[model samples]
Target: MSDHAVSGVPGGPVRESRDVADLMRWFGDAWVLPLLVGGTSLVIGILLIVWPNVTVTAVAVLFGVYLLIYGVFRLIESFAADEAGGTARVLLALLGVLSIVVGVLCLRNILQTVVLLALLLGLFWLVGGIIQVVAAILQRSRPHRGLTMVSGVLAVLAGVVVLSYPGISLLVLTVFLGIWLVVYGVLMILGAFRLRAAGRRSVEVTGGAAAAPAG
Candidate 1:
């Protein structure tokens, strides 16, 4: 429900930007982190909003895939969270495990999996938002710290709302899920570009791109 890049390659910045998802590496291909997560989230969000009639099985599969991708990236992000030190890294790692667990929960009947997700999504987002806030706090001087913190707060609010209304109708839940993914994806994509720019700046000054952000 919530999450948070740079590129290294030949060609002008124009061509380089297209390497948005060349690989999932965090340091050299730092851009991959957000782009992959953001791109997938955006696609899922669009599907949920525009294709409400889509089969539950299809949505469940896609959701599972998203969780797997998110888990992998988050696990790596935990390692890259240098500024936040060990505590933040550990929390991110645990969150990654949780994501993976839910993804693997796909083995259950499709309907059951979907219902479980609907119920668990709030807790997932709540924990993720808390981790984000903590990471931002630790890296007090990071660019956009205030905005990041605010977004984390928003995530917490969204989680609380969803949790408070567990019996929210399917249509309402779908809309909620769609809107959440869209906003989260847009923020991640924007952050990716910011990272790309920062990487360019680093390359100019120190002959290398900036490292990935802390989780």
Candidate 2:
């Protein structure tokens, strides 16, 4: 029996299938949005790096803006993953909320925000480094495993330095944050292109299936 017949209701299965296909298409096409966000992030990071002498208030405002944009983008991406369902969606939503809240707080009080942001940055780097290191170990057969391990080590050391010197001047913190942001933005842009390619492949597959003759 065909999927439509298995659904046991006229037009139900076909409609549902079409809906899912449409959602996938939408998700794939939406990759451009993330690319734009990443590009903006790169610009901000560059600005921070170039003008490291900017005031604390300026840096705080910039960070808040970046966080707000990041949070909103994350929420959109999470919602788009509706098919994932359950725990994954909930966790993504929670992360989005946390980012938004932290962003708002940063905007409200620049001085306090600096310290909190420093701590958060350090923790993020530390956790990310550990994950990278673990991933490198697991994928030892990969050609670039050595480079990945080295990157991970550097990330861990950077995290430690940030945490150990949390009281560092705002200029120094900005420089560190700027460098990380630039790297992250480049990764995001690369991911966007990948998504775009995947979307095209999905469309091609769906088209082929639709054109195929029924037995």
Candidate 3:
């Protein structure tokens, strides 16, 4: 007998089936915004690298505003969780406080934060691309090797692109990021409906079977 038959569970969660497609489209769609963010950060880093004197004031203002909003959201989320006695409530509260502190520190040292983030993102892409390349190479003998290799190449290319052009503006990156998130959100909603449809079909089939037995 099938697992579904044994368990009598009509359908699996919608998230699992649609997660891959949704995430892919999301990332693909939001590519521009992330690029913009990276570009902006790169520009800021370059400015700081060239003109350290102006870095302090620019960073201080930008970091302060970012942290203030982030901290507020974190604190509210933590407080709500704590009130509900959710698991890790205390941890959430602590994290909220920590984020607030970090935000304050960022305000004080915004230039440094931007530099660090840029470096980290660049390094991450390089490393991730390398890993994908290795995986694809290892799978070269497999049936789907061509597809896998292409994917790996694309990943590597994207990483290289980011590394090559790190001075794009943040606004553009934000927009790109927004596009992908919206795509994923829509996909997720669609997946839920698909799951519902599957469920209805299953029920109709089962009802037909039961009624036939009675007849």
Q: What is the C-alpha local distance difference test score of candidate 3?
A: 0.42
- For candidate 3, write residues 124-214 as lDDT tens digits: 3355445434544543222323443454355456446556756644443333223322332333334334434544554555444434421
Q: What is the lDDT of residue 181 in candidate 1?
A: 80
Where model 1 places Cα greater than 4 Å from the true spot, the runs are 1-28, 110-115, 141-150, 208-215
Q: How well does candidate 2 score on lDDT at residue 187? A: 66
Scored by lDDT, model 2 comes in at: 0.69
Better of 1 and 3 by lDDT: 1
Q: Could you give the candidate ranking by TM-score, starting with the highest?
A: 1, 2, 3
Report residue 195 deviation for candidate 3 (angstroms): 1.7
Model 2, residue pairs in steric clash = none
Listed in order, each prediction's TM-score against the native is 0.74, 0.74, 0.30
Report how far residue 185 has shifted in candidate 3, in Å.
1.3
Question: Who is ahead in TM-score, 1 or 3?
Answer: 1
Lowest-scoring 10 consecutive residues by lDDT in candidate 3? 176-185
Question: Candidate 3: where is the Cα deviation over 4 Å?
Answer: 1-164
Residue-wise lDDT of candidate 2 within 78-170, one digit each (tens)? 576554454545545655565677667667764555577677657655755665566556543333345545655766877898999878778
Model 2 backbone overlap count: 0
Clashes of each: 3, 0, 9
Best by lDDT: 2
- Model 2: residue 133 alpha-carbon error in angstroms: 12
